[model samples]
Target: MDNKPLSFKGLRLLVVDDDPDTRKLISILFELDGAEVLTATSASEALEIILCFQPDVLICDICLPDEDGYSLLRKVKRLDIEQGRITRAIALSAYVMDEDRQYAYLAGYQKYLHKPINLDELAKAVNDLAQLQQYA
Candidate 1:
């Protein structure tokens, strides 16, 4: 577990997962770290939130209730490109297979994380994305 306290004071984050517990856990973690977090229980809701929130980073589960994370990310990517917004995404899944990871990258996720997520690592990843955005 990484103990480093990440600084994400003003970063906006969206967490999409069908499991309410997962969403709540991630939301709490990010909020504790100073990130403004929004959560969606399904892919469709996620898309709607994306349009309105325009979050800086999105952490999504691979297996969603309505649509898969790959499909969600693809749509999000299209919307981002169309609107000229840069929103980096991360794929979170219980599947740790190489094929799954590869597919996530092909679908436009910048990072892939397995479930039973380490909150510290997630914070670091979000912080890193925020830093990268600053450089970009």
Candidate 2:
């Protein structure tokens, strides 16, 4: 068994959040799990990074400094299609309502996770989404 103890092996992850601590924590954890992570403090930065980084997956906070995660995901999804690329996205928020979850799904996020986040759940979500990309 090539057990390197990784849940994000070989994944390129883009983490977008306004909170410095949240961004840093996610980045450190994912990096430890063998993922290449890039973080953006705002939706604009995320958009710019998406064009260049072309991450395999995105983990975005629902509340952003500029635009919300829902809007950001829509823009990112459109841009990806234009570039003939496929990217997966996950939404993280403190909002734990059924409607919020529905909105996130409709906004192009594959998974919606609540905050304060569970690191293990986040890792599993990333792994699951990355696996789905292989089929896409």
Candidate 3:
């Protein structure tokens, strides 16, 4: 699993998920990858963190206790526009339908990963997105 760190060296990341286990799992993944990671349990909490932290990337779950990830992303992007900030986003979800994927893209997620997270793929996604975002 390349578990010796460095997969995401120096990257600042925020993960939003209502599920405690999901948040902890994702947080640990990035943390082990050498990222400075933060977690939020809801969309509102995510926004709060974004304002103060201005993280390099956002890894979020589609189904949240407060709001859907789609709308949360819209809000995040809108704030980015207004504040001249950029936060690359990845959508994590249990929805495995093609339509769900389409919605994620339309909602502005740079990438999407279904449940049963793959560490390699997720790290690769962060790597690719970081390259595009110029953080890698």
Candidate 4:
């Protein structure tokens, strides 16, 4: 096993999903790894939290209650550019279609995570985004 220790401390991550169960699971995973996790069940709430937290990374579900993740991501991109907040974002969704992945990239997600996310992958994405933020 490549046992490189993972430290999620000091990383602020936002988990946006309408599914409570998935949100809870992902939140727990991130918390277990020592990250500051924020949850938003709706796009409006997410926008509010995003404004306040300005998280280092975003892990958003592609399908939301009010709006799709792409729309929200576009808003985030605008905010990031306008406010100079370069937070790296990732798309978390069950849709694993190649077109979906392409759309996510086009929508500005730095990474795309499948629904049943591997914990290791999730952790790595957070760490990588944190590093990218540090460098940015």
For 1-136, candidate 4 gives per-residue lDDT tens digits of 6578878877899999998998898889878878899999977889999998998899999999899999999998898998987979989989999999999999999999997878789888877788889999
| Cα lDDT over the full model 1 | 0.89
Please give, for residues 1-136, the per-residue lDDT of candidate 3 as tens digits.
5455336889999999988887888788888768999999999999999988988889999999999999999999999999887889999999999999999999999999998889777888888788788843
Candidate 2 lDDT over 1-136, as tens digits, reads: 4444547778899999999999999999989878899999999999999988999999999999899999999999899889998899999999999999999999989999999999988987888889898788
Error of 3 at 130 (Å): 0.7
Query: How well does each candidate superpose onto the true structure, as a TM-score?
Result: 0.93, 0.93, 0.91, 0.93
- Looking at model 1, residue 92 earns an lDDT score of 96
lDDT by residue (tens digit), candidate 1, 34-117: 889999999999999998899999999999988899999989989988998888988999998999999999988888889899
**Collision pairs in model 4:** none
lDDT of each: 0.89, 0.91, 0.89, 0.89
Best by lDDT: 2
Candidate 1 is scored at a TM of 0.93
The runs of at least 3 residues in candidate 4 whose Cα sits more than 4 Å from the true structure, single-residue gaps closed, are none
